[model samples]
Target: MNRTARLYALVEELRAAAPRPVTVAALAARFEVSTRTVQRDLQALMAARIPVRAVPGRGGGWSIDPGMTLPPIHLTAGEASALTTALAAVDAATPYADAARSAAQKIEAAMAGPAAAAARELARRIVTLPRPGDSAIRTAVERALAEGTVLLLSYRDAAGHESDRAVEPAGLLAADGRWYLIAWCRTRRAGRGFRLDRITAAAPTGERAQPHDLAELLSGSAAAGAVRPTALGPLPVAIA
Candidate 1:
């Protein structure tokens, strides 16, 4: 379209054709431009100190330095828009929300010119606000899951009882616009799900979490259903 956009596209084209000759006729026909225009554009590229070398012989044309890499990879404007839009659909209170935001930033950084602009426009149409300060707890849960670290938690039940217990963070679950941490309770010695909002405090126990897959740990099994009167905080409950 515009000369500036065309220049960027040309750079990408040459990069894709690196170490291999791309005849001026092909470049010109691909862009629907005259041979003179292609020659002038190549001359401008040379003037800009780009390493575009000429190939000799009947089959030879123009080629870029084999070592040169322009964008590294190609992500079209449409693809970028779709990815950001999908990220926008994640719930705001979960660990994934923070990660999605960070991913969106990286995607934006990779896109340039009109592609970046289009992605921003698409993003504006898909609005979401991640919960404030959610990263603090979310990071802890994610780290615990990743490193298999045990966690010491100060949690409150839905009925307003509070207690301190140790758990092994399993996996994160998002449902009904709320966040929940599914974990293996050391006290109850069973798997349970705790609402993230109810976790008043959490700290690492410096111990490794027991090896357990989230699906198998939670499959067909329930926590110690009855919380011992003397041990009210042992089981957080899966369906509270």
Candidate 2:
């Protein structure tokens, strides 16, 4: 493999062995490279803000922080199809090029031979429907989700009067060509859904909200919204 490909593979190894430190010497031995080369790779990872730390002394090596999850590399055929389609749809959206290019590179780097060729071919052939205007609310929701923080939102009602609300953002959901925030509202004291377009301003509250049972919240909300009570009982569903 080339140096760049080998470096990517090394990152995978370090991330998989996270919280269990691996020394530069050990990595060099695995890749048949010099210890200096391994150290350079570690430096590259640190520059990317991957949370890699080097320990001091003979027993020390390098390690990633626990709970750091890399984006999944192993994609099934169905998943690959879905990703290509989604990427095509969002291709023209603002600042989407960076994420789309990054995803394509990761997939290409991870796969080999025929599989890589097929993925590229599929991506080339797909087309996405054009969407009008910027999706600022969707972008804000994603940022909040990634940082694990609450969002303070200024929302405008149908009549155009504005009100503020604090929500512990659980996740973002795309339904019927629009994005929605599936969140727990502190003011409402219940799980609520907010249409992204209705939001005027969203700022991080600088407070990390406590994690809740996402499945329970989604289930109860769905049950409450159901048109008719089930004859037998509430149908079981898994959320999150």
| Best-matching candidate per lDDT | 1
Residue 239's C-alpha lDDT in candidate 2?
96
In candidate 1 the C-alpha lDDT for residue 195 amounts to 86
What is the lDDT of every predicted structure here?
0.75, 0.70
TM-score of model 1 vs. true structure: 0.57
User: Cα RMSD for candidate 1?
Assistant: 14.2
On TM-score, the candidate that comes out on top is: 2
CA shift of 77, model 2, Å:
5.5
Candidate 1: pairs in clash: none
Residues 1-240, candidate 2: write the lDDT tens digits. Answer: 677688677777877887678988889999999999888888987765567888777777898775664744667865675565556546433334446756656556566677667777877787766554345655666777777788998887779888899999876555556656778889889887777777888888668877755555567564333332243478789998
Worst 10 residues of 1 by lDDT: 223-232
Query: Per-prediction TM-score, please?
Result: 0.57, 0.65
Give the per-residue lDDT digits (tens) of candidate 1, residues 1-240. 766566556777888877788999999998999989888888877765667877989889998885644464567788788887777667655665666866676577667788889888887888666554455676777778878999988889999999888998877665566667888888888888888888888787679878777776667745323222343356666985
